[model samples]
Target: MIEYVPVIESPCMSLCVMDEASGWCLGCGRTLDEIARWGQTDQADRDAVMAALPARMERLEGKAL
Candidate 1:
């Protein structure tokens, strides 16, 4: 059994924007699809996405806005 945990914090810094080559955000470390579909996603799905953050941030290559 899995316990559903609501995301207490969002990476969004009000700098919502997406890069052309990658679906990643320029401000927060999330993809446009992820942000858009967040409302409809289940806790498990959100967890899966959260688990991928490190890799996604790595792909960002330390770029800051």
Candidate 2:
């Protein structure tokens, strides 16, 4: 038997607030475009975007990545 696991995990932290200046979600660290495209994007593209999220979070928080 094989165990099933999700390929991509959503970053939504449930804050659901967008900052006007940066255009990034305060909770998930994803841009509006990214969020909108997430469901349609392929696995590789999704992975690439997910890879950048941590850096986005750092930038939004004014911290060094």
Candidate 3:
């Protein structure tokens, strides 16, 4: 049997502040919907998110977000 894992598991660090500009979690780069529904998603979904992290971080650094 194969096992699947999630790349992002709601990066909420108790800050829970919604970024009005992007609607993204303040702590984690995941969207609110992602945080709301993590356990249900499959590894593929997480992998996708993981793949986007570098670009996302780049964006963050580029814009200093």
Tens digits of lDDT, candidate 1, 1-65 = 99996655566778777866778876666887889888787778777888887777777765543
Q: Return the top candidate by lDDT.
A: 2
In candidate 3, which residue pairs get closer than 3 Å at backbone N, Cα or C atoms, i.e. clash?
Answer: none
Which lDDT tens digits does candidate 3 get at residues 1-65? 88895355544567566667777655556677777667788878877876765665466456663
How does residue 54 of candidate 2 score in lDDT?
Answer: 92
Write down the TM-score of every candidate: 0.65, 0.75, 0.59
Best candidate per TM-score, number? Answer: 2
What are the per-residue Cα lDDT tens digits for candidate 2 across 1-65? Answer: 99996666788898988877888898888889999998878889888988998988888888423
Candidate 2 regions with alpha-carbon error over 4 angstroms: 1-8, 63-65
**Candidate 1: regions farther than 4 A off:** 1-8, 62-65
lDDT of each: 0.75, 0.84, 0.64
When sorted by lDDT, best at the front, the candidate numbers are 2, 1, 3
